[model samples]
Every structure is written in C-alpha cells, then in structure tokens.
Target: MQLGIDQDQADANSRITAIRAAVLLTRSMELWRRERLDPETVLINLAVIAITSERLMRGGLDPKHNSLDVYLPLEKLQGCNVASIAAATGLNRETVRRRVKSLTSAGSLIRTASGDLALPPDKVQERSAQELVRRQLEALVRFANESLRDGVLMLSDEKG
Candidate 1:
C-alpha cells in the first residue's frame, strides 16, 4: 500500500512538471512570435536556430564564444550543418533545408561557407532581442517558482 502511494506521488509529480513545462513553452513561443524574430515560419525556424547553436555550449562554456556580445567569429563558430539539424529535429531533411534557407534569408540565421549555420552576432545584441530574452528568463523563473509551489519540483532544486 505504501509503495503504491509512493509510485502515485512520483507519477503526479511528473505530470505536474509536464503541465508547467508546456505552459511555459507556449508562453515563450508567444513572445518569440511577437518579437517577429522569425516571421517566415514557426517551429522549424525555432528548431533550426536552437539546433545550429548547439556547438557553442555542447562541450563546455567558453565565455569568449558564448557571451551575447562575444559570439564566435563566423569562420570559427562551427555550427551544425543541415544533416545534423535534421537529425536533431527529426524533420525531413528537405523540409529542414527549405526552412534553413528561408530563415537565413530572413536574417534569423547565418549560413557560412562551410555550410554550417549560426545566428548573426548583431541579432542578439540588439536592444529588442535582449529584452525578449530577458522576458523569457523571467518566465523561466516563474515556472520554477510555480513548480516548487505545486510540489512538482524537488525541494533540493530550490535555491535561496
């Protein structure tokens, strides 16, 4: 009986976390769309942006390359290529390719000579972009607080 109750609590916690996460993601997407950062499309554009940027922090954090004001030079960013993006996103390669092209043309992504893709440094440095990021961070903090209040997040995850 006790074991069953423990399992039920675990399952409830997982479901609550998922519910909070979905709401947070929806809010973030709303902010992203309102910013008009990728007017050409939606999920694919966001997916490509996130997938291509994995190189910067995948191994370790390099302050020089990862900071908003200090992104790697175009030649050295080594962002993911189409194949990797498609693999990560599980989208058809052709669809990923088309979206990447569109995003690149829209100035949301930068395709380099090596066929790697990354964001233009100026894209993040702009005041509006930074503001959008700040709002998203605020939403994340709210999500954490809500989760803790709901008992979805472990107390160990809380901080002073």
Candidate 2:
C-alpha cells in the first residue's frame, strides 16, 4: 500500500513540473510577441537615414549651410560631422555637430567627408519609391522566414 502511494506522489510531482515548464514557455512566447517593434515605423526611420546619407554623399546641399532641414525630423542621427550637416540640413548648430557623429555610427546616416555631411540623393528616392519598398520587403521576408522556422519547431516539440 505504501509503495502504491509513493508512485502516485511521484507521478503527481512529475505532472506538476511539466505544467510549470509549459507555462514558462507560453509566457516567453507572449513576451516576444508583445515586444515586436512595428515594422512600418522602423522602415520609415531607415528610409530617412538612408536618404539623408545619400544626400550628403552627392553634394545636393552644402554641409555648412543648414542641417535641420534634414536631421531634426528624422530618427537616429548620431556619430557624424554635425557642424557640416548642420550647415546643410539647417539643424541646430550645436545639436548637429553632436548628433551627427552618433547617427553615422549607428548606421542611420553617413558622412561624405570629414567636413561635409549632406545626405546622398540615392538613399532617398531617385527613380521610384517602389524600389525602396521592394528592398524593405525583401528584408522583412527573411525575418519572417526565420521566425516561422522557430515557430514550427516549437509547435512540433509541444505535440511530441
């Protein structure tokens, strides 16, 4: 009788452990879903950065003119030559120099020279916006593929 009771207790404990693990796994998935950033917002920011860098490279605007016309309304412009970009974009003289360096480092913008920092035109939209959209979609496809693969593996494990 004691042996039977011992086996039952062990079975119950095993079941409890499995339930806790399953709950943890579910919570992790929920967190990942909740933390996903909006892709459209990310794409817009990237577009602004790319366009600004392209402008600087092609010399559409002088780096010593106005920086705010370019950098202020954009996201993530650090690690660049701000005085130069400020001259072009019309951005704040002080902020331009400081933020430009940081933006360039973060890949949001690029500098054409040590002194000039206008964005290149190609980065913005030279021919058609469709091309830009296509490139962005391609990147999203790759991201989705990786996520789907992980989801499938998780689903299979749960069933087995």
lDDT for each residue of candidate 1 in 40-90, tens digit (9 for 90 to 100): 355665655676555655766566655565555665455577787777667
> Against the correct fold, how does model 2 do in TM-score?
0.24
- What candidate 1 gets wrong by more than 4 Å, as runs, is 1-10, 37-42, 64-66, 157-160
Q: Report residue 52 deviation for candidate 1 (angstroms).
A: 3.6
Clashes of 1: 0
Q: Against the true structure, whose TM-score is highest?
A: 1
Residue 52, candidate 2: Cα error in Å is 8.8
TM per prediction = 0.74, 0.24
TM match of model 1 to true structure: 0.74
Global Cα lDDT for candidate 1 = 0.69
